[model samples]
Target: MSMARTVSDTRLIFGRYLRQTLRSKVAVVFGLTQPLLYLLLFGPLLTRLGGVRGFGSGDAWQVFVPGVLVQLALFGAAFVGFGLIGDLRSGVVERLRVTPVSRTALLLGRVLRDTVVLVAQAVVLLGAAFALGLRAPAAGVAVGLLFVVGLAVSVASLSYVLAMRTRSEDAFAPLLSAVTLPLMLLSGILLPMGLAPGWLDAVSRCTPFRYVVDAARAAFRGDYATAAVGEGALVTVVLLVVSVALGARRFRAENA
Candidate 1:
């Protein structure tokens, strides 16, 4: 009965944000524009590089698109905290606190909405990639999409937790950039980590995001059954669990 109530509240909150997003069509288009630009501009230049040292042979788009998709997930989901901060400032969160909605549902609803938005962006990203020259098996493409949504869930939860803790966009924005840039750079989202110096490559192994990027690349290459894919999926699941738990705990503590 308690579980059913939580689910019902989550659906209600989810519907509220889903409708809000639908009303802002420009935000949806702009969320996809960065990846699309990278696909058109930076992508062609990579193809000219012929063979990157550690990257396997393929049309560069096959390699580049997965990286861009993950970047899309990374940048978009990590910034979701800004919206939460806005809610807090506008008293939206304070108003919700008086209601009986599950605190977990509050965080889960926002993260789930973020997941949906990022998945839509990923679809548009893949469409542009296909037009450019990317060709992965449908199953592989599905895997990549799953990876994107998993990443969205994990990142968005963590972002919201940080927003709650900081309670100020001024503090949150720079801190988020500091956290995300290092993760993005070391994760090899743009280039293979193998190309980095031996020690730098070794250091990347410490970041969970590296596993996710590897998993997406494996799926892009149609190597779904590989060990790397298994490790990547494991890392992503663990991240989602830990992040959601942290975010929910923070929300409950704040409201309590």
Candidate 2:
């Protein structure tokens, strides 16, 4: 009964957001345009900038492509929290607080829906990348799905942090770019981390996105290294926990 109620409540919230977003033509365009722009522009541009080191295969754009997809999924999910922050400031959070719906369910549900959409968007981008010579191994589909899952969780958590901690969605808007841009820049998104400056490589080592790239590349190749999986799982778990913690605290404060 409890699980059922939770599911129903979450579904209600998810439907609400999705409906609103879908109704607005501008919103749909903005969301789709992100990956499309990266696909059309960055695909050829990076491929043309000569050879960049690969994770292992040295295919240049191939290794770089997965990271870009991860970045896109992360950024795409960021807007869900922007919606959350907007709702909160406009008293939607307060309204929901007075209802019987679970706060965890409310936030988690949004994350779930947004993550799904982001992953689907990534498929389009990855397809475009392949057309531009970014070929994955035969296991590309499976690999991409796994990578998107890890990415969605990480971004959803970070988005939770943004929505809860920041004063408003507008205030948090620029920070989305701030957070994601570095994750891509530091990670082997456009070039192998080995080619990056020493400090940058060290920093990328600390960034979870780097682990995602490593694990993803391995997964794409069907290599499935234990070390890579462990690292990615660790970071994903830690970040998601932190997000829930912060979100809980903020929700309490808002209702208090």
Candidate 3:
């Protein structure tokens, strides 16, 4: 019964978040529009450029869709901590501190909420990619979800780290951009390793984004990149652990 109640409550909270978010019509459109534009406008454009030799394809656009979608899905991670920031500024966090609710759940709910948002973005953008001639077989859906969750967990964990330490939205802008940009470039969204310069490719390989992209692309092609998948998962776990620990420590210090 307690488990059932927890699920019910989580659902309600999640639903409330969805409704409130959708009500912000401008924000909804803005969040989803740019990704679609990139897919529609640049998908074919990049394809024509020819893929890098190492990437194993002449169709660069075809090679790009899965990785790009996952990369873009991380977009929402920047704002994932905004709710906590609001709660802090408004003193709601203080009220919750005295409550019986789970601390893990508080963070988990936000992470899950952002996951839904980011995954929805991933689907729409990927669907557009498919419409533009990027093929993803039916079975790809299962792997797609795995890729999405991996991206979401890493992203939300980052947001938690930021929120626990930084209170201002404006203060978040530079940091958020810094976090997302390098990942985007290094992840092979626009330029895969084959196309990248030697030094750059070496750096890119060190990033988990490269692994996620490689794994996601392989899944789409019906050949899993098992090594990349394992590496991405490993990095994601490490990042999540570090972020959670930092957030917890900072949360305690600030409250004290």
TM, every model: 0.96, 0.84, 0.85
Candidate 3 per-residue C-alpha lDDT over 1-256 given as tens digits, one digit per residue, 9 for 90 to 100? 1656546555655676677667775775677787787777777677766633676542565467776676666776666777777778988777765665445445655666777777777777767776777766667656756776766776776786687677788887678888888888888876667677899989998877777777666666666546766676676667667766655455445361
Local lDDT at 39 for model 3 = 77
Steric collisions counted per model: 0, 0, 0
Those runs of model 3 whose alpha carbons end farther than 4 Å from true positions after fitting are 1-12, 240-256
In candidate 2, stretches whose alpha carbon ends up further than 4 angstroms from where it belongs are 45-55, 252-256
**Maximum-lDDT candidate:** 1
- Candidate 1 lowest-lDDT run of ten: 55-64
**Where does the lowest 10-residue lDDT sum fall in candidate 2?**
49-58
RMSD of each: 1.4, 2.8, 3.0
Give the per-residue lDDT digits (tens) of candidate 1, residues 36-133: 88889899888876586787666667677888999999999999999899899999998998888888888888888888889888988888888888
Ranking the candidates on lDDT from highest down gives 1, 2, 3
Off by over 4 Å in 1: 254-256
lDDT of 1 at 59: 61
In candidate 1, the residue pairs with backbone N, CA or C atoms under 3 Å apart (3 or more residues apart, or in different chains) clash, namely none
